[model samples]
Target: MSEPVVGLVVSHATLAEGLVQSVRQIAGAEADALRALSNEGCGPEALQKSVRDALGDGPGIVFTDMPSGSCAFAARRLTLDRDDTAVVCGVNLPMLLDFVFHRDLPLPELVDRLVSKGKSAITGSCREVAGHGDRAAAG
Candidate 1:
């Protein structure tokens, strides 16, 4: 069997930590491959080092909270040095959940799947439900 790709969640404040904790909650032991890093009180170099340390030397997918920020900056740098690493920004719970279950896929395919899953998870319908004055979102 192929080696499962690791997942690195990098974000501001405690977002990264919270996401990983929640993933562990829902996925249990299977979500062990995913780790979290935060730029709460660190500079660029420190954040970069933390990201590298969390990612190690294995093939990994770095999920950043935003497309343009410190988290993305650190992860994007890794891709230039290693082909096995990928950066997928704007992460969500659904994306991480999908990733934990599909880590065995090839790096490129896994990244693509993550992006799709993340985008798909962002769905909502806020409209007037026939006769309701208050705005309601359909689930």
Candidate 2:
């Protein structure tokens, strides 16, 4: 009955900026939807308030870049008090695109889909080499 929410927390301005274009192309991820965790060259909570403020009274998801980073911790803390919010770490373009494309899906369902796609996108060194080798084999 309400619009979904999505936010991002990044380690650095440069890395965040780098993801902007790719996110735009895949998921229509917006600049306004992103929050920098290290503004003023300080710690994590700097962007938490801004992110919370941006999502005022809305039920949606938050995406953080690293699992062990402060951004993820802060996000976890924020959502701990709210039943309507979901925070996911290690977010990638495929996950975002899946979320955007399947916007009509239920919240829990969206989370599962995003996680599934995101995990599947991860490839180890051997897997990467094997994938290329398979391509070469086909050719």
Candidate 3:
């Protein structure tokens, strides 16, 4: 069986390097994470080629740093007309960590779980102060 792959796409090579380091810092040894990014003097096509070369006909997931940027676009193109691979943008620590943590799950289930976790990770807090600020004074 092929080893499961998780790839990252970034706008710049330096960013890609940092992502590799950060992913390892967060995920430890749970996954084989690779990266593709636009080089200092290159363009979006460079990112696309990087992804294609790294994936090389494998069942893998690609995560891009931006939802509507070159990196994301490249990943989308790479996985076009293919289901074995998934291209997900909005890459963040939570999502990447979740992917590695749940690597053992079956693909379909994993995807469902990841989406749920991703949504939950985003927060928008709006509430009145509780015991520490209001309720204690009220009661």
Candidate 1's residue-wise lDDT over 27-83, tens digit each? Answer: 883645999888888888888888888898978999999999899998998789888
User: Which number leads on TM-score?
Assistant: 1
In order, what is each prediction's RMSD in angstroms?
3.1, 3.8, 5.3
lDDT of 2 by residue, 16-131 (tens): 54565567766665555543334336455666675666556656677777786666676777787888788888877677667666655667887888899999877555665776
49 Cα displacement, candidate 1 (Å) = 1.0
lDDT of every predicted structure (CA atoms): 0.88, 0.65, 0.65
lDDT of 3 by residue, 1-139 (tens): 4456555545544666666677778668443555545546646777678777776675677766667767777778877766777776666666667777665666666667776777767754345544245333331
Name the lDDT value of residue 2 in candidate 2.
49
What ranges in model 2 sit over 4 Å off? 27-40, 125-139
Give the distance in Å from residue 22's predicted Cα in candidate 2 to where it truly belongs. Answer: 1.1
Clash list (residue pairs), candidate 3? none
**Candidate 3 regions off by >4 Å?**
1-3, 34-40, 126-139
- Candidate 2: residue pairs that collide: none
Per lDDT, the best of the predicted structures is 1
